[model samples]
Target: MPTPIPANARNPLRTFRFRIRMNTSAAGQYVAGVRTVSGLSVHVSPFEVWEGGNNLHRYAQPHKVNWEPIVMEQGLALDDTLERWALAVLEFARTGKAPGEAVKRDVFIDLWDGFAHPTEVPAPGPEARIRSFYVHNAWVSKYHALPKLDAMAGEVALLSLELTHEGWEPVPKPPASKPASPA
Candidate 1:
């Protein structure tokens, strides 16, 4: 069975290391790190601000934000899938909150069998760009049979500080923000 084409191939979401700077005079550059997608990725974590704190003076709280595009890039239906991922993430960034789990529903999708095929990429070490990917094994098996451990999810070993606050509750209500005007 051949792979399915991305229903949304025309325009995929743009995932990047985005930094929202809270500028300060001279050079006190404060920033908000975030992880966002095109709004279809389900079960995605939401956004939260990094309030200040420290641990025994060894490290101070990261006042700025740190972000990444969370979904894996297994290509194929890459465009459509990424769009969903982007939109979901963006919603979180603006609201500084996660969409309630009750509002999320998990659906499976097809992706490359990289986890099952080591030669496809490489022995992902602690230095690889992507850590892992989830394959709808139902789809994988329907297309190609698995010879070994029938696994659906594959993870890479690389480490990254993704999503500044994956588990921080927003204030009673986030202060309303105004749209940015042209500089």
Candidate 2:
């Protein structure tokens, strides 16, 4: 009998790190360790219909698609970049100022298949295979500042922002090239 390899054994792609880019205007604001991305998900509602009599087995029908909000966390910084970005949407919501064109921006979450590597401008390329997800028309819905501070050892202050987006789609990759025909 041959020895079977474990499912999670020696998988490089299993571990990944991600960074966020809030459109072109608010680019390069998110620092790697300062911010952590989470809660990028979608769910489909299951439709169930029950009538009188004839109960064999109940099957669920696929209903509307629901997209969950993307959550981001970061340590408090002096620049206050995230705080200002989130407040811009809040200001619009409160006074109906429309938030201008900058408010309606595309948010990109890029996943890199490895640990964090130091670079001036870290981007997805040959060295680190990256898969980016574009969240269309995103705006910060929730911005929670630092939680209750306590005199505890080794506690880091963190801020969180929840972004509500219309939809999320993966960045399209270029099609594979075809091999030349034999002469």
Candidate 3:
């Protein structure tokens, strides 16, 4: 069995916040019809997230992803990119940054093709419709620039994704990681 985290270990989730969003990609759909979900105003410790789940705080992991449904239609060709982009927007809303890594669709397919359908990460639920892999906001933002989220597609307009890491937690520094990065 894996060693358990000490009772006093600091929680990273408590120091950061989570933000998610939904969008469609029908030429002019990615920007339009998209909705933003703001996070609670307070930080949430991993203990609080796992709540009843055992060994929660002991494991430094991302909380369960509450994925949204795919809004595009069948053969929408845009569905795959749409969902992935929507998630990116939502992530930006929570982290103030978007995926900035310069990558090609081929690379993404290799990582998540088996998980979803066309390209997103594995959906957390059955009704979920995504196949593209999503990276941490910080990681993605460092290489990928978020597209304009409020506008419709057709035109390649870049939208500034709102980011907020509230309610998330960061393990408090114990004189070691002290002065921890503000989540």
Model 1 Cα lDDT, one tens digit per residue, 39-90: 2222434344443674333433435433322332222221233233334455
Per-residue lDDT for 1-183 in model 3, tens only?
A: 999977654333231111132222222122222233222234323423334556545535555443222121112232344435446655666777756521111111101113212223334332322222222221112212344356555654333332222122232222323366788
TM-scores, one per candidate: 0.18, 0.71, 0.17
RMSD of each: 22.6, 5.3, 20.9
Candidate 2 lDDT over 1-183, as tens digits, reads 999976534333643366666664644344444456777899999998765585876778999889998888887864466777787888888898865435666877766654434333434453443577888998888889876688875777888888888999998644545689899
lDDT of 3 at 25: 23
Name the lDDT value of residue 127 in candidate 3.
30
lDDT of each: 0.28, 0.70, 0.31
Off by over 4 Å in 1: 1-71, 74-78, 96-183
lDDT score of model 3?
Answer: 0.31
Order of models, best lDDT first? 2, 3, 1
Give the candidate number with the greatest lDDT.
Answer: 2
| Stretches of candidate 2 exceeding 4 Å from the true structure | 1-11, 14-16, 25-34, 49-53, 99-101, 115-127, 175-183
Clashing pairs in 2: none
Ranking by TM-score: 2, 1, 3
